[model samples]
Target: MNTPEPLASTVVIKTVNLGRTLMDTEQQPLTILQGINLQINAGDSVAILGSSGAGKSTLLGLLAGLDQASTGEIYLNQQPLTQLNEEQRAQVRQKVGFVFQSFQLLGHLTALDNVMLPLELAGAKDYRKKAQNWLERVGLGHRIKHYPNQLSGGEQQRVAIARAFAGEPVVLFADEPTGNLDQKTGQTIIDLLFKLNRDQGTTLVLVTHDLELAQRCQQRYLLQDQQLILQTPAAVNPVNAEATP
Candidate 1:
């Protein structure tokens, strides 16, 4: 008999009965997440859809090793987040990238420098060239020398996206990525995100209130009544469904 090829390793982020509770001044616990279970495979693009106060961002923070859940477990790339100390979790963060809605660029840093910050901190050489290349990829080549204050909101957001991709993180997460821009600019950023997805094979997880944007992903999740729920029978366009098969 012929020898079988080795099975590919599985890369996934998973959570079981994950929960969070906030304590008020009176010491009463207000539960935000209850029994949340989520699983995301490598190279999967997913949108976390929910209204405000639905614990969407909170869940992201926990999964990203930013915060501890009150109950349950989270495994990121087969490592137990709960078992890792703060420093250890920081190490894990090296393999993950994030984009924020607020365009969290430093006012003093130029677009190019902002994108180079992470790489330089990690002691990578030739950071300038790599940063410039990523900025160019986002169509911000001419604006690379511009400071955050000198750039428009959309331009700043593009810089942020460039920075996120510069790190080459295995998993990418975004919170309200397009919430701060005009419809046209936002649409452009969305297109760039998809391009990165197609070219880099990066796993994307985003939290958004926009239905149309969420529908673009392969999977969509909602936080309902303190639970993480995945809705099946995708609302994707019929054209897309037929093309998949």
Candidate 2:
């Protein structure tokens, strides 16, 4: 038997004692997440798993700096998110990309233009070429001129993926990238995600309820009872039976 090679030591994202709390309808305190400590290394694929309303998305939002933690600290590429202002955090988010279950493509924009939007905002010299290249890479070359509504669900998701990688982000956060598609189509999207992750060496942090999808990641954490629990391979199979969102 051969031992697998260890992941690189570079930490792209780290959190310490992270927590989030919200007020209930009556204004009483309700805790969504608490005491989360995690370290995601460079070029690693990580998955956050839990039942619906288990604070999985909350954790992802905090990790990506899209939302603030009510307590504790988060370090993104060594920049402290807990200390950054909104504008400063937005600046830090430039190195990140996102894919949503809804696909989140602008309906009015052509696939090509949708992919070009971020690059153009960043003032890339050749946004069109870069967008076209990514579209081609995602096997959407022929449909670049199509609008989101004109494409199939899977096709729209491909464009979304192309848009995400077009910026060459250091980390990609996908919240149920395959949630909208049928099982077969979802599998195709999953394969594309991992291929892009490996080819681009981008760190992947995925939030999903699908056990099979979570299993594909290098590291898996279950968000339950307001805590993050690392799952061993042996433990994953049992979770799969009941894992649902």
Candidate 3:
């Protein structure tokens, strides 16, 4: 695939001819993604729907600067990611946030403390007040003193969400965030997520296998054949898309 032309200033994320290759057990090359060109506008809610091994997470990692691509370039927040070093990338990440399936909370920290970590790292003042407010907003104020182990799976995830949004990030990357919860619990978490997303006007890049969840986003992409194809015109049938492993 060819690199796309420069997008408008509103574009928060843009990838050109992106690809990733890794070595298998025999040291042979395994291409996980190829020629994945994507553009995400600010405040856009986009979902990347694909099978388990379709490189959804991989692509997300590359775009988020958690990992690097083997080929091509990625520009995040209009800054060329490929040109930045690890420290520079870390600085970039400070402007972003993440919610994971495992609910990456600190076991030793209370929910309130966990949510405060990001703000503290960013040298923001009044961290306690801001974190407390976010926790209350997520309906976790009652459990703010509890640690990750003391909370239920849903509560833990809620803390994760609060932590992600407390920083008022420019973008939020969610990777199977609901994968570890039951249907009811997942639905609750999803509701909270979108609520905070809208309230904060944060750009959302969600990777999921759930079609219903994907449909909730404003833009959708079906990742197949190591490429990203837009599911626009509301005519792309996801029912026929390949299943995740």
Rank all candidate structures by their TM-score, best first, as comma-separated numbers. Answer: 2, 3, 1
Alpha carbon lDDT of residue 223, candidate 2?
Answer: 86
TM-score of 2: 0.94
For each candidate, give its TM-score against the true structure. Answer: 0.90, 0.94, 0.93
Off by over 4 Å in 2: 1-9, 243-245
| Residue 44 alpha-carbon offset, candidate 1, angstroms | 0.4
The stretch of ten residues in a row with the least summed lDDT in candidate 3 is: 236-245
lDDT per residue for candidate 3 within 168-223, as digits (tens), equals 88999999989999999999988887887798889999998766677789998988
Pairing residues by index, what is the TM-score of model 1? 0.90
Would you list the rank order by lDDT, best first? Answer: 2, 3, 1
lDDT per residue for candidate 2 within 15-63, as digits (tens), equals 8899999999999999999999999989999988888899988898999
TM-score of 3: 0.93
Local distance difference test scores for all models? 0.84, 0.91, 0.88
Candidate 1 per-residue lDDT, tens place, 129-165, comes to: 9999999999899999899999998899989999999
| lDDT of the structure predicted as candidate 2 | 0.91
